[model samples]
Target: MLIYANRDAVEAWSREEAPDNVDVLIRRASAMVGVATRMARYEVTPAGLPADDDQADAMRDAVCAQVTVWDKAGIDPTAVETEGRVSKTSMDGASFEYDRAAELSERTRVASTLCEESYDLLRLAGLIGGRPWQR
Candidate 1:
């Protein structure tokens, strides 16, 4: 239940007033971030946010970006319905087919819940993967 983004933070990141379900969005987004960054260990604040200011802000922005994408997609994050990119298309029949979600379980999570902006935010924050160099 670690919520990385609040109403005010989400609103500021999105540059728009948050919706009534902002808490719900934050919960879902935070869960997605946890899953996405399970490999990276970060020092957290007393409130459970990243200790590094930049990383913490990036996390908030990433969560907010995810919320914005979910809000735009109109998909209920709490629901079990499958929604995402089209998997199949037919040129002749003019048919389109969407991919059904793979089996879902608490531990069998997927990255489809994350949006592009969120991914980029985490990447830039050095949370997803670090940039190593030698001088």
Candidate 2:
């Protein structure tokens, strides 16, 4: 398997570590690879682990940044669970509720932007479309 990103890169980017959360980091990194590969229409094989180094770096950075934010928020990005909701009522009786499942956090949005930028870069590089199964 081609690990385009590593613990060192993530640590360097986030400047924090749990020493015990390596598995979680690995899961997030793997997810980044899966999504990036799918977007690039490529298969992640030993021979072609990193179809493009720049794309891989961008994807890894995005995932790592998101993972870091999640860690700071005490949430597991890979966990399949509800983030719950918060409701607030104004003095005038107006009420509002924020839906966690339906909304993205600012940090999360930033991470998504990074990933999108990475995809865009790859697309411009002509590395964005080649389905392995098409062969």
The most accurate candidate by TM-score is 1
Score residue 24 of candidate 1 by CA lDDT. 85
Q: What TM-score does model 2 achieve against the real structure?
A: 0.50
Per-model lDDT: 0.74, 0.54
lDDT of 2 by residue, 25-114 (tens): 556655654555564554344665555666566556655655565556555555434455576666677777666745545434433322
What would the per-residue lDDT of candidate 1 be over residues 54-103, giving only the tens digit for each residue?
Answer: 98888889899988876665655776444443478789779888655443
Candidate 1, residue 43: lDDT: 93
Give candidate 2's total backbone clashes: 0
RMSD of model 1 against the true structure: 7.2
Relative to the true structure, candidate 1 reaches a TM of 0.69
Off by over 4 Å in 2: 1-3, 41-47, 83-135
